[model samples]
Target: PPRVRECVGPPLSAMAVQSTPVMLGAAGLCFYAASRTFTSPLVPSAAGAVPTPHLRAGSAAISADAPSTFSGVVPAVGLLAAAAAVAGGRAATSTTMRRAAKVKKKGVRVVEGKEIPWNIFSPKAPYEGKVIANHKHPHTLTEDTGDANWETSHVTFDHGGKVPYIEGQSIGVIAPGPDKKGETPAKIRLYSIASSAVGDNETSKTVSLCVKRVVEVDGKHANREVGEDKPDKAGTHFPDSKVYRGVCSNHICDVNVGDDVLITGPTGAEMLLPEDPEANIIMLATGTG
Candidate 1:
């Protein structure tokens, strides 16, 4: 990456004898080289000329003290083109960032006078809920689960009436232990609550989540060390790729009847049901909304 300067060439006065067409062609090449090579155009000093860069790697830079003649115009035009290119690129980038910043979060709906339970348990303080039921949904069931195309589960947890949530709200699930980065208490993953405030058992003491086991190839952890674990386990290996299982979703799906899970928040007010009984509701969702 070290810049190697070439020896200084002859004065532009001597080159002025060249044909006008030849001088113009050289000026065009100069413009293209300057625009492609540098973000800041090279400026000729009051007493000296601009550096004419050679396109190839390690090619020496030639300096010419451009006189007040036709030959002097080559480097001058190139300098202007380079500066314009850099300025235009920066302006486009600024416009893109401004457009992205304009996007806003969805507004929370207020139906006359309905109280919204927003963040009863936060990420800082989470609720411990026990698993009441974890079963495969009938829609995702296959004759041979070993080669099942897709696996989705309906997992219910016992909140002990402490964590109350309305229908259409979501709860955050924190996977047990240090994550792949060795950070203790992995980050929370939110899933929509599939049950109403009274719950599936109608006791108002439980909450449920619909989760799909996520299995896919991940190139991010390709260089990570995979343990000598079974293929059915988390770090399943492939011949030329790395297969990853979802940390939180897999944990929730694999949990047994009595396993305790860290739960946070009956959060999100945007999806709350309108209080009006006769209000028309049209829901359209895919996968696990």
Candidate 2:
């Protein structure tokens, strides 16, 4: 009998191992062909054909070293483009973070030409502003303990387009003439700003204050001297008392439209509005704060 060989299939793992190398070889050949096609010069239509003198003269000579040069240069160009894209992305991210930091530091949204004014007019050299309007509220309460009939006034001043202020800041009002202490120049009283940066009428030239007349009764007063205080017939300790008005409050409240008043300072930074539009704000105020 002739020698017989048994037919047996190779194991699955062995088949996979054999196929992998073949596939790898095919892939490598394909990659090399693709690279050569990209980086190598165009081949002439006919092989072993000599170029005519006129054709050679008209066309630039192809250098033998050019294909190697292109192979290196193409990868370098691609890498440069990728680097630039990454750098641009990082720069954009950095800029966004810087803007956010600025907003957080300011605590308020920034408005165009609306920064908190510092000493626009100092107490020494106060701005002489004309009272544009002094409107009285119908029912207003004073900060004093007494339930006195006190009035709140919305006093607007025209600074001839010089004074600029934002909301939540304060300005100083110099009460004319001598103080109660007999000082020659009256002291400057700071009042919270009630209007927006653009004044009452949206003009960039004016500012307004909400002032409540300060008044005190005999019972609330610390001093026991010099006031007509009469007890009720029932001998109750509470008594009818006199009302003493504040010099600055009275001056501001009594001011009429077109009257000139001395003003100083557009100060205070703690109450300034934040620059971010989406920021949450909570305000706690009482009695013309």
Q: Model-by-model lDDT, in order?
A: 0.65, 0.63
lDDT of 2 by residue, 43-155 (tens): 44356866333332244445454445356556655655565556555655665687687663222333455544577788889999998753432223333344542456677
Which candidate leads in lDDT? 1
Model 1 TM-score (2 dp): 0.52
Error of 1 at 166 (Å): 0.7
- Model 2: what TM-score? 0.50
Our model 1 lands, by Cα RMSD against the true structure, at 19.7
Instruction: List runs of model 2 lying over 4 Å from the truth.
Output: 1-115, 134-146, 219-242
Q: Report each candidate's C-alpha RMSD, comma-separated, in the order given.
A: 19.7, 21.7
Candidate 1: lDDT over CA atoms?
0.65
Clashing pairs in 2: 107-274, 108-273, 108-274, 108-275, 109-274, 109-275, 109-276, 110-275
